[model samples]
Target chain A: MVENRPVLNVITHLVLILGIVIVALPIWITFVASTHDAVRMTQAPIPMLPGGHFWENFTQTLLGSGLSGTETAPVWRMLLNSLAMALMIALGKIAISLISAFAIVYFKFPFRMMFFWLIFVTLMLPVEVRILPTFEVVADLGMLNSYWGLSIPLIASATATFMFRQVFLTIPDEMLESARIDGAGPLRFFWDILIPLSRTNIAALFVILFIYGWNQYLWPLLITTDTDMTTIVMSIKQMLEAAEQSPQWNIIMMTALLAMLPPVFVVVAMQKLFVQGLTETDK
Target chain B: MLKRVHFPRSVLPYLLVAPQILITLVFFIWPASQAVYQSFLIEDAFGLSTEFVWFENFELLVDDELYLQSFGRTIFFSAAVALLSMSAALVLAGFADRVVRGATTYRTLMIWPYAVAPVLAGALWVFMFNPTLGIFPFLLDMVGIDWNHYLNGTHAMMLVIFAAAWKQIAYNFLFYLAAMQSIPRSLIEAAAIDGAGPVRRFIDHIFPLISPTTFFLLVINAVYAFFDTFGIIHAVTQGGPANSTTILVYKVFNDGFVGLDLGGSAAQSVILMVLVIAMTVVQFRYIERKVEY
Candidate 1:
């Protein structure tokens, strides 16, 4: 049997190897391209290998934007802002999803179904399509050009609420009944019982929210006009427009690949957890 | 089971729901209404100065040949991208599901493309398709076909479809693989024991079980393709090569931002909302019935 299977296994491995090459090549090329100077990248059959100008390019990119270079992109500052903004988004989503899910599932009340349906209905409204009018709300609330403007609206996603609720619905009633018999009050039982059991679900939500927040483009790009408080995506977008002609493809590619790292790492490191978390959705 | 509920718990539900309500209203409901309101007005050909003319924008949008053509093109593009991406993902994910060696690595590599920013992905393909240095042009030259996206409408449209497909294939793959992994292995084995060949077992057993997930993803992906792809289009071609790539969302953005005609953009947006809402209603009325859970 082992001898007979060698050819099939070889084909499988070959296909997988090809898959990895295709998946990693664009990004791998981008990473190397970032290290080289811009002038070198324009050459034909561009270098297939990494160059030695990484530090030089990195330093120049950081300083390249600012008043000195036609409205310089504060890449580092935006990195910090992006981290802060994405963190807020992640934290806000988790807290809200957990709380809302608990309320709708564990504690029943009037209009419960109404509210649940309402939250779920929110999923259908594509934010990109509705963004123009929402700008007016941002203006009306005086939330424009601030972290509040960037973070507030995103926290309202019905998707996470829907996700957490689905996770909650799967647990057997026996656990809750047993906890109640043990004299564990609501908060104590939820903290000790529910939260511990749902760690995987929470982690999945974290990965999902973090990536969504990190990759946000149009809204942040449109809303935040201030250079000091722009998200990484906004900064990247500005860099794209500013450097459209003869773009330092290396630096831009580097930033793009770097931006993608955290999410990719989240998926890789938590592969087992994320898979379980995703698979658990139907429950 | 009907014991008296505590007061704190009674108010707790509202507290939990408050943030969602506030954010949704401000970001979604309010702005959506505003978009509808602005759709009724008119702006001059110059576009900067706005004047209030009731239903003129909407009326004009109804009679506009350019809008009609672009709208039809948008529908065709959305349907094509969604179906192609979904089918591709299902096949790849199904293949990955059975492959034991390096399965995790393969999954990770495949899904990483989803994380690439839209602009970056768009730009990456531009490099690939550019005639002076693009790999595709190199490909076309060997085949004795002149393929230039920068100047050719057909080539540019193909490039847009491929780029858009690349962005979504990763996401759909993740969902399908996740769905397949959830199916109990015992059933698959049992089906195999009954003499279901690989292809037969897949069609009869696996596809049905995965249909719910497939259906759910269909609705979600359909919405994404219909409304969220303007960025990819905007970044790649700006609806170039004789406006063949211009879709509805791109037109909305172009009119609102570039042309400085807010009224016209809003009118187009209103029509956009109607189409989306109608599609959503149909999805729920007919397609959603197939969702198992």
Candidate 2:
């Protein structure tokens, strides 16, 4: 913008427009396909515009048994399961990480650094790398096919702990000194001062972690065997498989839309926090 | 790293850390150790018995062509995804950085895709490229190009790569745009005064300045493609078309959970853990350097 060259500005706009289109085409196609009837969706060169069957498709996908042949849970049940899993993971990680970070930052205790390093090591052991043994552990604990199974094993987050630790370190030492002078115990200090201070950080992290928890695939896929326990994210795979025979593109795409809507809405609605959370946590 | 003025030392800290420590022990450390232990012991198919055969699984994997190819494929996939997504993001970010008006609008339009799950990304792309009914194939057919990921190995890889890259563009765009915007405006203005065009200034000045962000994103995207794209591959191809798209993570899951090759899968897990550790070390090193800068 130093020197506005007319041609360059035009080109920039064109390029950005093109980039947005290409980036958004898949979602657009999914939306258009969802709006159509099953008969029209199966035909070659499916309708590129909205169809009249949008309500029918949404109601059918949400309430009707998925794909007719597959023994899947109702869409509402799966969405509830996904919501439950996401909330548990986000809240659990924030709670434990805040306390652990508080302890590490505010206390001088034995094996404190050792404890920090233990949490740090979890960064290297993503679930994909240790699929078998983690599965065995979950199975042995009889956690399979439960909400706890879906959420808790994934709740211990090194990144969240580290981010909170960083946040705690930035708070001036005088706050704690004054709180101590006012006869506040450690828990009171944490609840009153630290929690309020890090509220935005917690909200930001919640935005990121909620999407993360909602989008979990491999863990939930492995642990959840019951139909009612299926997450909407995981059920898309089942619907895709079922589509080989049924080709219920309208219902399938509607389900896909529902599967992605919550996280996408969270991101768009709280984009500032989402971006802040992403950069901070990843760093 | 402790504060100068802190609470008195007591058993309270232990209680504070106990929940995280317990979860880490039960889920993270114990399973990781089991993976290492089981890697050395070959288990019978029926869970009857296991014989301690140290390094045999590793040795077999080293000699196994399929495992080796999967390792290579994983590297290639990671590189391609990083390149494709990064370049696209770079271009879009560069332009977005230029336009002052509607910058946030452009950003909002661009970044929401980051929220889409990998599995949903796969589902969306797979639907678009569905050979019989999809719009992409229909369009590609007009160009006289066949597109069937079901039977075509190359097409399957392309499909997953596209889906993975598509989902990742939003993340890379945000980072790249942030990095680019943080560059001092005076520098670009000075370059323009010196008769450097936008493209030349971009290549000569802006690009070099953001190299740290580039390096940081490269590692992040590499790690992401390695681990996070499991859902995409699972939903889209299932590592199929004769296992052409089977990366290391997929192969581990396939061999362990589906095929039930316990020792081999454990060995694979151990190797993957090593890879992750190495990547994490590199990323941390870069982050440390970024801090210094």
DockQ of each: 0.38, 0.91
TM-scores across all candidates?
A: 0.86, 0.99
The candidates score, on chain A by TM-score, as follows 0.88, 0.99
Model 1 / residue A191 / CA error / Å: 4.6
In model 2, which regions exceed 4 Å deviation? B291-293
lDDT of 2 at B72: 93
The CAPRI class of candidate 2 is: high
Cα deviation at A117, candidate 2, in Å, is: 0.3
- Model 1, span B198-268: residue lDDT tens: 66878998899988777777776777677767666776788887889998888887877677677888888
What value does the lDDT take at residue A69 in candidate 1? 45
Q: By lDDT, who's the top model here?
A: 2
User: By DockQ thresholds, what CAPRI class is model 1?
Assistant: acceptable
Q: Model 1 off-target regions past 4 Å?
A: A1-6, A62-70, A108-110, A171-193, A242-244, A276-283, B1-9, B43-56, B142-147, B179-214, B278-293
Note the residue pairs that clash in candidate 1.
Answer: A65-A72, A65-A73, A66-A72, A133-B31, A134-B31
lDDT of each: 0.72, 0.94
